[model samples]
Target: MTSLVAGALLAAPGVAVAADAGAPPQPLVGDLSTWGSPCAAGEGRPFVRAVPNLTARLYGAGDHQPGEASRVSGEFEAWWLDGDGSEERLTFATGMRSDSTPFSWQLPAEIPADTVISWRVRAVDGEVASPWSTEGEGAPCEFVLDRTAPGKPVVTSADYPDNNNWTDGAGVYGTFHVDSPTDDVVSYVYDFQGGPLLRATPSGPEGSADLRYLPPAGGVFMLHVQAQDRAGNLSSPTYYTFRVASGRAPAAHWSLADAAGSRTAAATAGAAARAGIGASFGSPAPSGTALTSTATLDGTGHGFLTPDASVVGAGKTFAAGGWVRPSAVDSVRTIASQDGFGAPEFALGLRQEDGGPVWSFAVNGTRMTGGLPEAGEWAHVLGAYDAETGRARLYVNGRAVGEEEAVTPVAAEGNFQIGRSHGASGYRDRWKGEIGDVRVHDRVVAPAEITRLGSRAAQLRGHWALENAPEGISAEAGGGEPLKLAAGASIFRAGDECDLLDPDCIPGDWPLADEGHLSLDGTAGYAATDKPVVDTDDSFTVSATVRLADNEPAHPMTALSQGGVHGDAFKVRYTPATQSWELVMSHADAPGAAETVVARVEWPDGGQGGGHRLAVVYDDATDRVRLFVDGHADAGGTAEFHDAWESDGGLQVGRGRTADGWGEYLRGAVDQVRVFSGVVPDQDIAGLM
Candidate 1:
C-alpha cells in the first residue's frame, strides 16, 4: 500500500465570485404628502432592515410651514413603530451626515428578531413640532431587523455506502434538516469539493436535494450544506465526505476526485492501491452541475503509482482511457503512462510535433499519432493496444483518428504514473491540463465500446450537430471527412431569439439551432470543411437555413460563398441598403475582366426579420439563375456565362473568400447547409425545404 499524503489546499484565485448588488442608491427628497406635515418621504425605501447586522435607512427632510424658512430649524426625528402600535424615536442632524439628509436609526435592542418595525418621522424645534410623515395613510414606513440565523442543518439522510464510499452507476440523494426559531428557512446552498456553490430553495422549511455531482465521473467530493433563514442569515455549514467510484471499474482506475490531494486511491475492484502526488495541485474542474469533473495538474508536477500488478501489469492487450482538457500544448502533456520516457511500455498523451499538437500513443516506444483536439475543451481519449494483432489505435470523443501496426505490450518494469512519463532513469515530461477518470483495462477495448463512453459530437457533410456532441455521429457522418475549426472559432449557445428551423418539428425538440450554433464574430471566426464541395460545371444548387441578426454596420453579410469573384463562384448575401436577398454569380467574361450576374429578390417581410430559408439554383439547360424562399421560386433571370463557372477554392460558410481576406462575415445563425453537384429540380428542392 502506498502512503497517502494529503496535499495542502491552495485556493484557486477568482474561482468563485459573490453575487453583485445593483447600482448604488441615488439621493432624492422624500414625499411628505402622506405624512401631512413635518417630515418628507425620501428615496430608497420603506426598506427591510436586518437587525444586529445589516440595516436600511429612510432619508428625508423636515418640511417647514408656509411662513417659516425653507430650512426648518429643528432636528429630524425617526420613529421605529412596531406592528402592535408601539414606537421608539431616534434623531439625527439633517444633511450633516453622508448626503442622505434624512434621519437614520438602528433597530432598537427592544425589537425582537424577525419583527417588523413601521416608522414615521417629524421635525421638532423647542415648542414647535411637525406632523409625522408616513409612507401611506396610517401606514408608517416599515423595516425588519433579523439578528438570528437558522440552526445548523443536519444531514438527515445520505445515500452513501456503509463505509461512506461509492462507485459510479448509483444515484445520490441527501436531505438536510433545518429549523429556525425566529424565521423560516428559505434556501439551502451546497458546495461540493469547493468547485461551485449550488443554491436550492426549499418548498417550505425543509427539502431534499439530489446531491450527486453531475455527469457522474469518479472522484472524492466533500459535501458542505448550509441553510439560510428568511432573514438571510446562513446557518453554520455541515460537512461530510463522499467517495464516488468510477462509473465502471477498469483493471485499475484513478478518478482524481480529491481536488486538494497529493495521493489518490485506485477505485479498481477490491483494490486499495494509491498514487503519490508531486508539486502543487489545482482546483477541481469548475463544472458546476455538470455531469463530470476533473483535477488540474501543473506542467512541472505529476502523480505516480508504484508497480501495481492489477493496473500497470494489465499486459499487452489493454486499454487506457481518460478525459483531458489541455491549457496549452507547447510541450508534451502526458495523460496516463506506464512506460518509461521514450522507452517501451504504454502511454497516451499529446505532443506538439511539426508545429501543432497531435495525439501521441506509444507501444514499445513506437509512437503513433492521432488527430488533435481543440485547446480548452474536454476530450475523452482512449488508447487501445492489442498485442495479438500488433494493432494500436487512438480515439478522441469516440471518433477514430489513427491506428498503427507492430504495437508491443507493456514493459515488465513499468509502474503506472499519471501526468508524467517514467522510465528506468526517472520521471519527466510533466503535464498541464485537467484530467479525470483515468481507467486502465486488461482487454483491448473496441471502438464501439469507446464511443459509448465518450461525449457526443456528431459531424456530417461539413455540418456538425455540436449540441448533440461528437458522440452522436453516425457511421456515414462528416461526409467521410472531419470538420476542422478555424483558429479561434467556437460553438456558442444561440441566443434565445434564434430560430430553430427544425425540419421535422419534433415536439419538445427545438433541436440544436438555438442550443449550439457555429459562432462567427466577423473576425477570425470560420471553419474549414473537412472535404471540399466543388461546383459541378455551371449547374449547382446552394441551400442554407439562416437567421440574420440585426448586426449594425450591416454593409453586406454572406452566409455561404465559394472561392473568388471569378469563375463559377457564387455568394448568398443580404443587402441592407436595398433590403433584398441577392445571389451573385461571377464568371470569366474576358481574359482580365469577369462578368457578374446577380439575382435579387425583395426579402420576405421587407428583410426586417430572421429565420428564413435561402437557396440559389443555376441551371445550364434553362440558362437562368433562380432564387427560392422557403420552397417556391422567388425570382429568376436569364444569364449566359462565357464558360462553365468553376473554382478550386473550397466552399466557405459564415464568410466569403479565405481567412487571408474574408468579406461580409455573417452575424447570425447558419445551419442545414447543402450543396448539390447539379441544379436541384423544383420538386426535389420543395421536398428538401
Candidate 2:
C-alpha cells in the first residue's frame, strides 16, 4: 500500500483523497469543480489563489495500496499559463515517493511588468497519474533600475577676455562659466596652438574654468575647451580666436638726428622731408643752385608760392609773362625739368624746339613731355595743357602766340629741375639762362599776376646771408693772455714769482684761475705746497689734438686730474688689463669709500700713435659725463653728482697729483680745450665733422 504524507498542501482545497487499506488507491481525476467541498458542488469551493512570491502544491497517492507494497515512487511537474493558455514550464520533480512532501520553487529573474504568473501542478504515482489542478493567476512583480538623474549640464555663459592687443611677452588670461547639475565637475582640458595644453578642475555649482596663456609670437591663434563628467562623458568643445600683438609702445623721447646741427629745415615741411634729410650735404649740392624762393615746391614740381619772398604764383594760372634769362643761354631749356645730380638725370627747361622761348617742360631720360610756351624777348612764354579740362593755350608777352591740342597728352614725371632734366646728370638738354621769378600755381596764372611778379623780381636781388657768427669757441685764448693756438704748446709757465694769484700770469686766463703756474712744464703731478692749493676746478672741457710720442708709456697713464695723491680727483686714464680708457673719480680724504668709475672704452692698436682730437665734456643738467677721442664717443657714463669741483682746489690738466715729478704726464700734443655748460647732442658732433 502507498502512503501519502499529509504535509501542508498549498493546492486547491476540498479535493477528495482516497485512503483505503490493502488496496491500491485510484488516481484522483476531476475538473476544478469536483475538487470543491460537497456543500456547494465545485463552484462554491475554495481554490488555490496565486499570489506574488507563492507556489502551489499537490499530493499524490502511492501505487502500494491496501497490503501490496509499503512505499510508492512518483513524479510531479508544475507550469505557468497565460490567459490564452500558452504554457511555460515552471518546475519538475522526479523520483518523488508517496512520502515526499511539497517544496517551493523560485520564478525566473525577469518577467513582464504587469504579467500574471498562473501555475498548476500534476502528480503521477507509479502508473497512476493524478489530474491537473486548476490554473491560478495573480498580480505580477517587477523591479526597476533607473540611472537618469536631474539633467545634463548646460553651458550658461563663457567669458574670454580679448587678448588681440596683448603684447608678445605679456601674460594673457581667459575664463568661462557653465551651469552644472551638481558641484562635482570631474575634469577639464584646454588646447592651445603654440604652447603646452592647459587643464584644471571643473568648478562646481557655478562651474567656471580660468586659464592663462603666454603667447610666443604675433598671429591668429585658436583655442578650445572641453569638459567631462565623473563618468567620463565629455561635453562639446567650445572654441575662440585671439591675437598676440608685438611689443608694447615705448616711452616717448625726442632725439635729434645726426644732421640736425647743420641743415635746418622747417618743422612743418611734412613727413617726407623729415625722413630724407641727411646729416650734411657732403660736398656738391644735390639740387643745382639753392632756390632761394619763398615758394614751397609741393614735392611735385607744381609750386605753391607765397608773396612773402616775391616768389608769387601761389594759386595763379598763366597766360604768361616773365623772362628767364639764363646765366648764359648756351642751350635753352624748360624751367620745370629734372637736372643736376643722380637718378632723374636732367630735365629740359623747355621743349626741343629752338625757334623761340617756349614755356614747355620735358623729362629727358623718362617718357614725360609737355607743351611749348609762347616766345618773346626775354621769353614772356605762357603755355597751358588742361589735363582734366582737355584744353591747350599758349601766349607770348600777354598775346596769343600759338594754340593747339596736344597730340600725345602725357603727364610730367613731376620732379622739376631748374637747370637740367629729371635725370640731372648734366646730360643732353640743360638750362643755361638765369631763371627769375619762376612761379607755378594750381591754375593757370593771368597776365596781370605774371606782370606783377616780374616787376617785383626786378627789385628783389642779392642773397640772404646768415647774420650771426656760428656759435662756437675757437682754440684761440680769449682772456688778457696772448692766444696759444699751436698743436704741441703748453699755456703755463713754471716759477716761484710767476703771479700765482694774478689773472694775467695764468696761461689761458681761465675764469676760475687762483694759484697760477707752479711749474714751467704744464704737466700735472703732486705738488710740494703744504697749504691746500687751488687748481682748475671751473667746469670746462679740455680738448687736445693728441699725437702719441715714441717714448710714451703704455701703462696706466693719466690724461687729466685735479686733486688727491694718486687715484684721487676726476681723471681719464687707461687700464692695460682691459685696454680701455676709464673715467675714474676718487678722493684722497675718503679712501675705500666707494670711488666711481663712470665709463670705459677699448681702443684698437692702430688707433693710437696717430693725431686724434680728444674731448671731455662735463654737463651739469643731465649729469652727462662724456669723453671723445678723434671725434668719436670713446667712453661715456652718467652720474648724479652736480657739484664735483671743490672751491679750494685748482684744476690740473694732462696729469694727476704727484709728489716728486710729473710721472703720468701725457707725452703728446694738446690743442683745443673748450668748455661749455650746455649738453651737445650727436647732431652737434656730426656738424663738426
Candidate 3:
C-alpha cells in the first residue's frame, strides 16, 4: 500500500485546506464564469461555466443536474458586478458536480435600484477541488424602491346651512377628498380651531370624509384635514375657515332647491358674485317684511303706519295723536313710540288728573281738560292742528277736549314719537300710558282719525307672559303664558323664599313663589346640609336685585345651588371674608375633587348690599359658566361634563345644599328668580336691569 502523506496547504493568510496524495490531486476551484445583471423582467436563470478537469472525480456528486457532491457541504455562491468588475455575492450553495451546473439567487430588500448582478457556481471534493461552471451575465433588471407618498387632502365642498354667510351658530358640512396615485392612503386627522373635530379613513377607490360641526358661541373657527400613507408618510394639511355667531338659534335647514336658487341668481350675476340675492329669492323671504300698514295689525296692539307717505308727509303743519290704556297704573310710566319705546323721539302727554283718579292728555305740550279719559282704562284723546291754518283742536273719545290758536308750526322732522318724545328735550315729555294706532297726515287729521284711534285703543288692553325666566322662581297670571320667576332679589336661608313684589322681602330663608312673594320669616334658622338642591330637568338662570344689609354674614355662603341628588352640582356663592364671589362646580363621579372656582368677583368696597343685580348663566353649548353683578360680567369660565348632573331635585334659591338639612342660608332681601335653557349675553342682562 502506498503511504498517503496528508498536509495542510494554506489557501490564504486566514484560510487553509487539506490535501492527501492517495485521495487524488485537487482541481482548481476558482474562476467562476456566470455573473452580471439579470433580464429586465427579473426572471432569467444563472449558471456557472469553467474549464473542467475530467480526470478528477467530484466527491459531492448527486443525481440533480447542477450535480451536487458530498465534499461540498455549503451552498454555491454567486454575485453581480458593476461595469468596473467589483463583485457582490448574490447567493451561496454547497457544491457543484458538473461543468454545466447552474446557480440562482433572489433579489434582497436592501438592493440598490438599477443594479446589475452576475453569478457563478463551484464544486469541491475532500482533497480534490472541482472547477467553477461558466459565468452568465443576467439581463439588466432595474430595482425599484417605493418613493411615493399620498398627496395633500382637499376640501371638495363646504356649506353653512344658516345665513350661508358663515355667521354664528350655523350648521357646517365639510367634505374632504384625497388622491394617492402610487401608494395607499390609510387614515386622516382633522383639526379644528375649537378642538379636534373628526378623524377619517379611506373607504374605497373614490372615498370621501364628511363632518357636521357647529361653531363655538363667541369666536371664529378653523378646520384642517391631513392624510397619511400606509408607509407613514403624511400629506400637507388643508384648511377652512368658519364663523360662530353670538346667540342661541337652531342651524338653518339646507335643501337642493335652495342651492339651485342661489346658483340661478349667481349665474345671472356671474357665479363669482358673493353678496347679491340668490335665485332662491322667489321662495318666501326667510324673515318677514317690517310693518307696512295698519291692516296687518292683530287688533291686540298698535298697527304699523298706513304706507301713505303723505301721513308722515314732507313739510306739513299737522299734529297727530291717539288714545292709551295703562296696563298697570303704577308710579313709573310705560310708553310707545316711533323710536323704540325703550327710547323715543316724539311724544304724547299723560298725567294724573286734579282728582288724582283720572289720566289726561297734553298735545304738543298743550294741556286740555275734559278731553282725555282716566288711567287703568281705555281713554280717548286727539291732537290735531295746522299751524299754517292757525287752528288747533283736541278731542276726547271723538269729542273736542280743548283747542288753541296755532303758535308754533308742527315740527316737520321725519321722525315721530308716540309713547314718548324724541330729543333729550321736548315740551310734552313722554306719555305714561300704552298708546294705540297713531296716524299722521300732511293736512290736519280729521275727527275720523281720532275716532279710529279710539276704536283701536279698545282692543289693546292685556298683558303678555314672559317666556325666558331667571334662576329659582316661577310666575303665573290670571290667564297667559306662565311668567318665569327669576331670582331678582336677595339670597335667603331655607326658610326665606322669593317675593316678586316687596323688593325688600329677602331674609335668611329659602323662598318659593307661585304667583307672589315667598319670603322666609328671618326669625327661624333654616339651612341645607348635604348636596345643594335644584330643579331637576328644568334649566334656569339666577338673577337677584339685592340690597345687602350691614349685618350680612362674613363667611362663605351660597347664593344659588344647582344640584339635587348625590351627583354633579354647581354653586354661585359669595365669601365675605375673601371679599369675593365664587362659582364652585362639583361632580359625584370625581368624589370630593370638585372643579370649582370657575369665576370670581371682587368689589371695591368688599360688599354689594346697597342694591345691586347679580346673575349667573349656565349654558350647554359652550358649557359656559358665567356670573354677573350689577349688569356686568363678574366672572366667566367653561367646562364640558354633559348630562352628568341631571337629577330630580327641586331648585333651592338662597341657601347651600337642600332646604331640608344643613342650613347655610343667605341673609338679605330677594326679588326675581329666573331660569332659561339658553345663554343670555351681557347686553340682554343690561337691558333687563
Tens-place lDDT digits, model 3, residues 164-210: 35453422223334344434566777776747556777675664455
lDDT of 1 by residue, 1-689 (tens): 11112221111243221111321121123332112222222332322224432122332134222332333222333344445555544443333333233334443455454444444444433233333343124334444556666777755434453246463422223333433333366677887678779887665433433443431345675668887765567888888665665444467766665546656554644354455555233445423113245677667644443335436553456778777778878777778777544553677888887888887887777777877554565677788776656678877765677656575566565567677776566676776777776777765555556766554321113334434224322111444444445643455554334445755443321322436555456555555453456543435677767666563435677777775443326767777777667776665422344545465555533213446777777754334677776776643533444344556666766766423356677765555666665456676765543
**1 or 2: which has the higher TM-score?**
1
Clashes of 2: 59
The CA-based lDDT of model 3 is what? 0.40
Using lDDT, give the best candidate's number: 1
Flag the better candidate by TM-score, 2 or 3.
3
TM-score of each: 0.35, 0.23, 0.27
TM-score of 2: 0.23
Ranking by lDDT: 1, 3, 2
Evaluate all candidate structures by whole-model CA lDDT and list the values in order: 0.54, 0.36, 0.40
TM-score of 1: 0.35
What RMSD value applies to candidate 3?
Answer: 27.5
By TM-score, rank the candidates, best first.
1, 3, 2
Over the stretch 1-689, how does candidate 2's per-residue lDDT look in tens digits? 11123222332233222233422333232311111211111222222212223232335354333333333332223233445556544444445443334333443444322243333344544444444443233112111211223234343223334454543432223334434454435566667773567777754445555554544344576666666543344566656576555322211111111132333223121111121221221121111123232111212222211111111121221121224433333344544332223543222245544554344532223323333332211333444433334444544433444444433233332333333333334333444433333333333333453333332111111110111112211122332112212233233322334555676664322211122211112233222212222222322344434333323246555554545543345666655557666666553424353456665455533223434445555543233466665566742544444334442343334465444434565544333334332233434543321
